[model samples]
Every structure is written in C-alpha cells, then in structure tokens.
Target: MSNLNKLDFSALEVFGRNYLKWVQDVKLHLIVKNLHPAIEDKMDNLVGEAKKANAMIFIRRHIHDALQTEYLANEDPRALWVALVDRFDHQKDIFLLEARHDWQYLCFQDVKSVNEYNSKVC
Candidate 1:
C-alpha cells in the first residue's frame, strides 16, 4: 500500500479519540456503556496517529456536503432550502438564503427551532 493509505489509518484513530472526547464532554454515559469493547480498543490504538487526520476528514466532509448543496441550489434556486435540509437531516436545521444572483448561504439552527421555522416557511 502507498504511504497515503497507511496514513489514512491515522484518521480512524483520531475519530476514536474524538468520539471519546465527545462522550466525555457530552456526558453520554448511556452511549459509552453501549459502545462495543472491541471497537473501543481499536479506537484507543488509533488515537495517537489519527487526531489531525480525523479533524481534516471531518472538515472535508462538511465542505463537500455544503458544496453539494450549493450545486443543487445552482440547478434549482427554489429548491436550495430543500437540498440543505436534506443534507443535514436528523442532525442540524439548515436555513438557506439567496446571497446573490446564483449563490446561496446556509444557516444552521437547533432541531426544534428548525422544525418550527420549517413549518412557517413551508
């Protein structure tokens, strides 16, 4: 395998570390209790090499998702909000506004607020 492939494994480790941090920060005791032991061990092993890679992966994924929404908005101006909401379904509430002639801007809200906003908009 190439060096890049080997390095990619580091991202897994970072994901594990971040998952752990999230669990602690959020005090997700139930989630931690339910997580598989084997998976936990694997994440521990990958922690050292994966931190930076994991963050990069996360940012890239979000950017990619946003760009995809932008593309969809370009294809259909009226459908931009639909595309943003679809992309962030089950997690975040997205609001889309036309920023310019063909560009759209996205704003995120909490799920409850988003639902209320969606009801008003729709």
Candidate 2:
C-alpha cells in the first residue's frame, strides 16, 4: 500500500476530505460508518479488524497522538474516525472568524490600481 499522507492538526479539513477520498478508493469507507455485516456466514469480527488495521496504518504519529486514550483504546475504525472529526472540526469556527475579519478589512484604495486591488481580493 502507498503511504497515506500525515495530517498535522491544523490541516484537518483538508485531511478529512482527502481521507474520505482515500477510504472510498480502498473500498473501506463503509467501515468508518460503523456498518460492516458478515460476509457469506463468516464472522464480522475479522472484517472489523481488517478495517481497523487499515485505518491504523493510515494514521500517522502526530494525528494518532492527538486522540484521547479512550478513543485509542477502541479497536473500531469508526471510533477513531469519529473522534478525529469531532476534535478537529471545531476549527471551522475559527476559520470562519478569520475569513470574516479579512472580509471586514478588505478595501479598494484607488481606481487607478484596480489590478492590484483585484489581485488582493482574489
């Protein structure tokens, strides 16, 4: 398996998006949803373990460290995935405030410098 990129806490949003794409690509997205039924009378425990292992392999050192002990103790991939999202998704509020601050400060100084002003806005 190719190495999945590490996610530093600050890059959670980007990481979450990329992680979803990666899980889907690997056909393991359903595992993160906590929905894995037994296959052909086989035990679901094996499938669950496989998914957990797959998730553990993708998690890098830093992000793994951010998890709570309870979450780390859980062998379920859905638990880990939910914990990560819950912890990091709170940053969206900070991002929104920053964007609003930037918008409030945005200005067009001079009509003569429209190109420069447009570049800054972009």
Clashing pairs for predicted structure model 2, backbone only: none
Q: Which one is best on TM-score? A: 2
User: Taking the tens digit of each residue's C-alpha lDDT, what string does model 1 give over 15-119?
Assistant: 132332332432233234332221232434433234333332332232334354444424322233234334444232211222342241233343357777678
lDDT of 2 by residue, 31-99 (tens): 443443321134445555665565554442334243434456866555655566565556567767988
Candidate 2 wrong stretches, greater than 4 Å: 1-48, 60-70, 108-122
- Location of the lowest summed lDDT over 10 successive residues in candidate 2: 33-42
* Top model number, lDDT: 2
TM-score of each: 0.18, 0.44
Q: Name the regions of candidate 1 deviating beyond 4 angstroms.
A: 1-73, 92-122
Question: CA lDDT, every prediction?
Answer: 0.33, 0.48
Pairs clashing within candidate 1 = 10-50, 13-46, 14-50
What TM value does model 2 have?
0.44
Displacement of residue 83 (Cα, Å) in model 2 is 1.2
